[model samples]
Target: MGADLYRDGVARLEAGDGREATRLLEAALREAPGDVKVMHALSRALDAAGERERSVQLLELVHAKAPSEPEPACELAMALLERTEDTRAAEVLAPVLAAQPDHPGANLCMAMALAKTDPERAKAHLKPASRSADADQRAQAAALERVLSGQSPG
Candidate 1:
């Protein structure tokens, strides 16, 4: 029931209905409380609403609630990255990559974070991302793949 509402919120968010998505996601969160997926949606809605701090808070809650789940960790890393907190992003994504060596987003994110300060480490993290089975990986893998090929990532 609550999950359905959250799913609808996600659909709405993807459809560009940011306001409705936020409302629906909030309603779902009220019902499900600590549900990871709902929290994820709420974070996204808040971020899309330009409430970056609130989104970060929500995702931190998700991270606290599901320490072993890579999705929230990855999202948190992304949020931190947006803030240009590259070191923190690297810290958050490192363990995720260690746990799932082939995780597309984690690998790409970690690589992206490491790129500026340490190009070699960035290349190391990005190797698997280029070959990831996930389609989202392709877009992210662009710079990394180029970097690993001795070309400029940017």
Candidate 2:
């Protein structure tokens, strides 16, 4: 039941029906309390619904519950970065980066977090991210690379 709701919620979110996604995801969370997958999906739905604070809070819980899991850590760090919480994003990303330096998403988030304070470190992370199978990650890495090199991100 919870899994079905979770899937439907994620599908709705992907379809850009944020409100419905949030509703379904919330119900899914209730049905499967403390389910990290449901929590993560709900966080995305909340963010899409403009409930940034709630989204970040849920992501924080997801990360805390599964710190060793790269996906949650990367997702939380990305959320923190969106809030301009670079320090906390970097802190949250530490273990994931340490564990999987080659993980595209982790490296990308780490690069963004360190871009302002440590361009060199950011560049190091970007190296791996630039080679990611995901085109978006590769493009973002390229853009950040341009920014770090004092060129406009065009």
TM values, all candidates: 0.84, 0.92
Pick out the ten consecutive residues of candidate 1 with the lowest summed lDDT: 139-148
Across residues 1-154, which tens digit of lDDT does each residue of candidate 1 receive? 7988898999999998877899999999999888888998888888887788998999888877775567888889888888899999888876677778878778888887888888888877777787878877876788566866688867
Query: Which residue pairs collide, candidate 2?
Result: none
Residue 126 C-alpha lDDT in model 2: 96
* Whole-model lDDT, model 2: 0.91
